[model samples]
Every structure is written in C-alpha cells, then in structure tokens.
Target: MPADRPYDRRRLLRDAAVGAAAVSTAGLATGVPARAAAPAPAGAPITAARARRSGAVSFRWWGTAGWRIDIGDRTVLVDPYLSRYDTGLFTGRFNPDTPLTVDAARIDPLVDRAENILVTHTHWDHFNDVPHIAVRTGARVVGTLTAYHLGLAYGLPAGRLAPVKGGEVLDFGDYTVEVVSSLHSRNGSWSLAFPGVRVSPPPRPEKISDLPEGDTLAYQIRVAGGPSVFFTGASDLNERNLTGLTPDVAMVASAATTSTADYVPRLMAALDHPKIVVPVHWDNFETPLTNPPTVAASDRERLDDLIAAVRKASPRSRVLLPEYHTAYHF
Candidate 1:
C-alpha cells in the first residue's frame, strides 16, 4: 500500500485509541456546561428582536459528517459523530460490528449548546455520538425508528426521541426542518466504506456495528427569513425526493473513495443546483481530532473531481471548503 493511502486500518485504530484517551482525560478535566435554552418548534417565526439577538445562521463543521447549525435562539446538529472510535479493534474486522466506545468528555464541548439532533443514518460515524449529545443537551433526537431505539437503549428520555420515516416537516420556532427520504451510497470501492446494513428494532444491540442503517434521510433546513440549507451525509441521493428542492446552500459529502464517481454532478442536478456548495466528510476520519486534517493522496484527486463537477454542473454555485471547528455564517 502507498505510505499516504490514508485508509490503513491498523495504523488508524492504533492512533485513534491513543488520541481518544487523551481527549477523554482532557474533557473530564474541563467539561463545559450544557446550555439550558430549549430549541423552538419548527415554523416558529423569528422576530426582529430574536433575530438581532442571535444574528444570522452559523454553521460549524465538527469533522466527519457532523454539523452544528445555530439560527436565532435554536441550535440543531446533523449526524454528529464526535466520539472518535478505535474501529481497528472490532471483532467484525472491516464491518462496523463493535460496541459503542464514545469519548463522552471529548464530545461534551461540541454538543453543549445543541437543542436538536438530526441523524442521517445509523452508521457508527454518523450516529455514535448522538445519544450522549441528546442526554447532555436535552436535545430532541430525530431520525428513523432504529435510531430512536438506539437512543432508548442509550437511556435517552422518550420525550426527547422523535422517530420518523421521512416526509415530516417540523416547526422549530425560528426555522422549519423538512425530512426527505434518501438513500445510502452503494457499498463499493467508491461508495460507503462498509457493507450497507440495517438493524431490527425493539431491542437495541450492544455493539455499534449492530446499529444498522435503518433509513437514510436528508435534511432541508429553512431558517425564517434566512438562508435555506440542505444536508446529505452519504454520497447517494434520491433524485425524486430532492427534485424541485432548491436550497441556498448545500453541504455535500465529498469522500470520493466511498462515493460514486459522478455523485457531485448528480446531487447538484437533483437539488436544482444551490448557490453555494460546501464539501464535507472529505477529511480522513481515522485520524485524531487534535491533529490537523490530512487529505489522503487519493482524496486530493477526488476533491478535484468534485470541484470540477460542481463547476461544470452548476457554474454559478460557489464551493466553500470549510476548516474544522470554524463557523461559517450565512
């Protein structure tokens, strides 16, 4: 294998373990208090005073497929997987069948202010940290029935868990969130790295890998009188579901190795081409959070391809490459 291939499982697991331990210890030593403000219901109007108090919608990327969106007095999270796991030690080997090994201390700071959590699927990286975040922040957890069961197993209060099978439009006071049915990327060299799997409900499994991809979803979040944003955690898209949906900003996953070769253009066309596109999930996940993001030799090419595709398909769309932990106001 090339030295900079970036998917060396053994090396990734080893480093992740060490990094997780350090983060856990540090987080325990200096944990931030969870915010007490509750999230407003969808469709709630954003008054001028409230808008001035909260300013414009701000988005912060938390590595992997996690995003923190703050609008008015409400904060919503999408596919937050801040608990870096040491997947190299799983018994299932390449499969994601492993017990949840979340670094709670590490995740506390990122989720302290969140009032709502939206999960795209039940994959380890997209859903692992959600239970902890919900419990800590008193945020509503929204997703498939599988995700709700996982939350229940993780001890989340029933009231905080909202189960859905897509096609739900929620009113959160200052913003409206629409849940659209979506599809996970195919399992192949240029798609999701693991086999596409789903877990049965009623009794949540003890292992993380057992947590299946119940149902994939994409979120079209429209802030009252503010920018509308669309989020897709996986590379695949259901064109019919997204047709006629035009968002001002689109956060598209850019992991080339785990995506179809032409995902970018297809996604762009499906959403009617947004004005701004942000490439996310392009960073190597196995690496530690404290370390700077590393673009694998192969990923660099994939990113270039994505950019070219975006330009060709949507010439007017501005592609923004976000830095980790940095907030982008829209």
Candidate 2:
C-alpha cells in the first residue's frame, strides 16, 4: 500500500490484528484525535438569525452524509451524524468494536430545532448520532423498517419513528419527503461492510458494527415554494428509481472507486441533470467537525474525480463544494 493512501479498505480488512494494533497506536499519535467528547471549537454553530433568515431555505453540511436543512423555523436533518468518532477506519486499522458516542455540545448549537430526521442507511457514520438526535429534538425518524426497529432498540419512543420501504410520499405541510429505494456503495469486491437488516428490535447497539447497513434509501425533500433537494448517503443508486424526481439540487455522495459504471452520467441523466450538484460523503469521518473539513488523500482524489465527472456529464449543472457549518441557500 502507498504511504499517501492511508485508508485502503481491502488492506485494512486484511491486516492482521497485531499489525492493526501497531498501526492504530501509531495513527493515534500522528492523526487528529477524535473530538466528539471534547469541547466544540469556536465559531462552529450556525447563528439564530442566519439559521432562520427570512427568504430562502438554509442548508448546512455536517460532514459525512450529514446535513441540516432549515426551512424557515422548521428544520429537517438528513443523516446528521456529528459525533465523527474515530473508529480507526481512516487510520489503516479499521476497528468494528469502536463504541458509539454523541457530543451534545458539538451538535446542540447547530441543530437547535428539527421537525424530521431523514436516514439513508443505518451505518455508524450515518446513524450513530441519529437516535440521540431523534430523542433530543423530538424529531420523527424516517427511514427503512430496519431503521425504525433500530431506533426502537436504541430506546427511541415508538411514536417518533416512521418506517418506510421506499415509494412513500409523505406531506409535512410546508414540505414533503419522497422516499426512494436505493443501493449502498460497494467495496472492492462489490460488498458492504455490515450488510443485513433488523426485522425486529434487537439488543441495544453497543458498538459501531452493531448498526448494520439496514438497507439503503434516498430522500427527495421539497419545500412548498422553494427548491427540491435530493440526498443519498451512499454513492450507488438505482437509476430507474429516480425517474421524474428532477430535484433542483442533488446532494450526491462521492464513491470510493469507479466501481459503479458511468456513475455520474447515469445519475445526472436519471435526475434530468440536476441544476445544482453538491458532492458529499467525501470527507474523512474519523476526525473532528471543524472548518476546512478533513479530507484524506484518497477521498480528496475521489472527490476531484467526482467533480470532474459531474462537469463532463452535466456541463450546465452548478457544483458547489460545501464548507462545514456554513449556510447555503438555493
């Protein structure tokens, strides 16, 4: 493996325990420590005035596949995992036993209000902070039946969970969320990390791997008089499922490799070549949620490739690279 590309998934999975321990210790010494339990850095929160600013709906990237979408006083969070806990995934020593955690100090300031939480999948990076957020803000958790069961297992109130198996058009007064069945991004061998689903509530999740992929789903959120935005936590998708969505903005996740054939072109064409394409899920999730987000060497390269592909496939579509905690209006 090259020194620059620290996070080779196949290599990380193949590494022996002894070698992984050594690398993990070395990584902790050299890499940025996980700050989910530490005090949030200054200037991390979106202010009240800016969050609820009059005219347009506000969207802020929270790293990974996380996003905070504020539609007036009501807020909708999509995969809002702010913990960013170090699981050794990006340190060349992936540990499936990393305990789940949440830092209210880090998440509270930014997500003061929310009406709903849209989950794409139950992966740790996407769902670890979800249960806590759902309980904290009293927001309805919407996702697969697996997500509902998992939320129940996590002690979330039963009434707070809304399970869907895709193709559900839910009206939330000012806005609507149309659920679409989707596929998770594949690894080198076209496999997922922890693939499975919880048909019923199981034991309380204690570690990272406990949260399975739990099936993948995408969401298209459209504000009554505003723009319609599409969000997917993973890179791969079923083109047929996106037929007539034609969202104004699409939050496309960057893939680890070109495993999905013509990913950009297919997605662009599927969504009628969205007007604005925002690349997401490209940042390193093991680090702190700070400004100038941390992008591993491999992720940076993939992001560049994704951006170029978008430009080539959808020349007219505007691509916006989001900065953490910064507010963006369509």
Candidate 3:
C-alpha cells in the first residue's frame, strides 16, 4: 500500500536525494528525472497486417513514452517524440537552452500514417515533434488546453488540435480513447522542471525550456472487440482516475526516484493488474532509437526495480520491456 494522501513535496525530495557524491538526478531538466541510456537486447520484428482483420492491435514503441498503436486501418500515436536530438541530458552536463529540433528524415517514415496524435503533456520531449507530425499527417492532436495553445503557437491549425480535460470517451469508429487527468513525475526536489501552463498561446518555443510542463495526462486506447492499452508519459499517476480502467496492456513509466508512494505497486493494483505491463520512458532519450535501446549505468538498477515491483504486485501479469520500433500484438 502507498503512504497516506497529501504528500509532503519538500520532505520527500530531501529524503530521496543522495549526498552530492551519490546524488539522484531523477526528473532533471528533461522531465525524465534520472535516466541513463544502456543497450537493450534486440527483439524480433513481427509485422502482422493480416492479424488486424481479426481484431488484433499492433503496438510499437518509439522510445521515451512514444507509441504507435494500429487498430485496423487507423493509427493512433501517444506522446510520439522520435527526433531524439542531442540535448546534453545524459552527458552529465544538462543544458536547458538546447534548441528544439525536428528530424523529418527519421520521423517522416514512422508518423506518415497517424490519424490521431495524443499529447500527454507539453514537455519538450513529448510535444516537440507533435506539431510537425500533426501537420504532415493531418491528425487531430488531443490533449490539455495548454497543449492546444502550444499547438497553435507552433502554427498548427486551430481545427487540427483538440483540447481535452480528461473524462472524454471519444469514439473513432474502430476504437475509442479515454483521457485521464494525471501528474508529471517529480524531480529530486519533488518539483518539476519548467513548470507552468499557457492558458493562451505563448511565444513560439525555440529552445527546449521554452516549453513548460503544462500539466500531464495519461491515455487509454480501447480497440473495438480487441485489447485496451494504457499509456503514461510520466512516472507518477493519479490513482483515483485509474480505477476501473482494467486495460489488457498498460504502458507504465519507470520512476527516476522513489518520490511517489509505492509507484509501481499502487499502479498495478489501481489498474486491476493489467494482463500485460509494457514499461515505457525507461530508456535513454538522448540516444537515437536504434536496435538495442540504451540505458544508463545507474538506470539499469532502477529499471530492474520497476520490473521486479510489477512482477511482485501482479504475479500473473506479463511485463514486456519494449525495444524500439518492434511490433507487439495483443
């Protein structure tokens, strides 16, 4: 069980932090807190188009909380950040002024078919490539009001962005999406980086810090007569909002530190112990999305802890650590 409600942000931050020698940099500038990239074993690439006709849903991880979910002929993307440009995040020298970039050459191939793009927050890693992808694919960008404002600031057409404040069950013929109000993962200080919301359109974001947290959210994509998948862009979640979700697959994020109360265990129970738990946002985001995904030396232990906790909490659930671009069918 988790600690009592009404947490003490400052106290937790102080207790969770190690001395300067072993400082935990979780939820640092990149909002991933303290993740490092190390290589992961390669997974077999299984593309099953024919399986789609039988109500099979295909899922592909785009690294750092991004996913490509295919339901029949339509495609839905969640926090799809494929640019993976260098930001000095994992290099021990964090740079807040890193310029925002778009790698069309890389993103073009993966995102050209998306019909709907879900934004979990306005953080740079999650939202940087959204505008470009939405414009190119003409997909509807659904997220918070701040995400909508950021989309407009990025020159995305008003009609192309849909502002949702959770509790919206949108039917898209072959599937439906349920938006849940959520929270961003806290840093070692029990605070978030670049925290703030833009109620209205703000200046165009040029550098990474220019884009604020703008709040966070989680998404549940339910395929018609098939499987339901839950995606979280940040490690922390709103337990109250997750009740009764009971997804077939849950793409849970790994915590950078132990700030949240029993992060993994509480989530597994709240979601009714999903049949499959796919851990996301665990790899090194600064590195390119290639075979053998990278994890930092320190992050290796954190990733193991997350997996172990999931297994203990839900012994029957299968925990799948995703490899970049590898297809998974449920």
Candidate achieving the largest TM-score: 2
After the best TM-score superposition of candidate 2, give how far the Cα of residue 62 lies from its true spot, in angstroms: 0.5
Least lDDT summed over 10 consecutive residues: which range in candidate 3? 11-20
Runs off by more than 4 Å, candidate 3:
1-56
Taking the tens digit of each residue's C-alpha lDDT, what string does model 2 give over 1-330?
Answer: 553343456322211111111112122121221112211223334433443344336788898789987765677899998978878776667778889888788788777767799999998888988888887799999999899999999899889999998899999777889999998887666566788999999999999889999999999998777778999898788999999999998999887655678888999999998888877886766778886566655344565677788888998887776667766776
User: Which portions of model 1 show Cα errors greater than 4 Å?
Assistant: 1-54, 89-98, 189-204, 255-261
Q: What is the C-alpha RMSD of each candidate to the true structure, in Å?
A: 8.4, 8.6, 8.6
Q: Rank the candidates by lDDT, best first.
A: 2, 3, 1
lDDT score of model 2? 0.76
Candidate 1 lDDT over residue span 35-59, tens digit each: 2233333356456246535554577
lDDT of 3 by residue, 1-330 (tens): 122222322212111111112212222211221112322212332223433444335687898889887665567899899898876665445567889999999899767577899999988889999999998989999999999999999999999889998889998866789999999887666776788999999899899888888888899987766678899988888799999999988988877677688898889999999887877777777777885666665456676677679878998787666667766766
Best by lDDT: 2
Please give the ranking of all candidate structures by TM-score, highest first, separated by commas.
Answer: 2, 3, 1
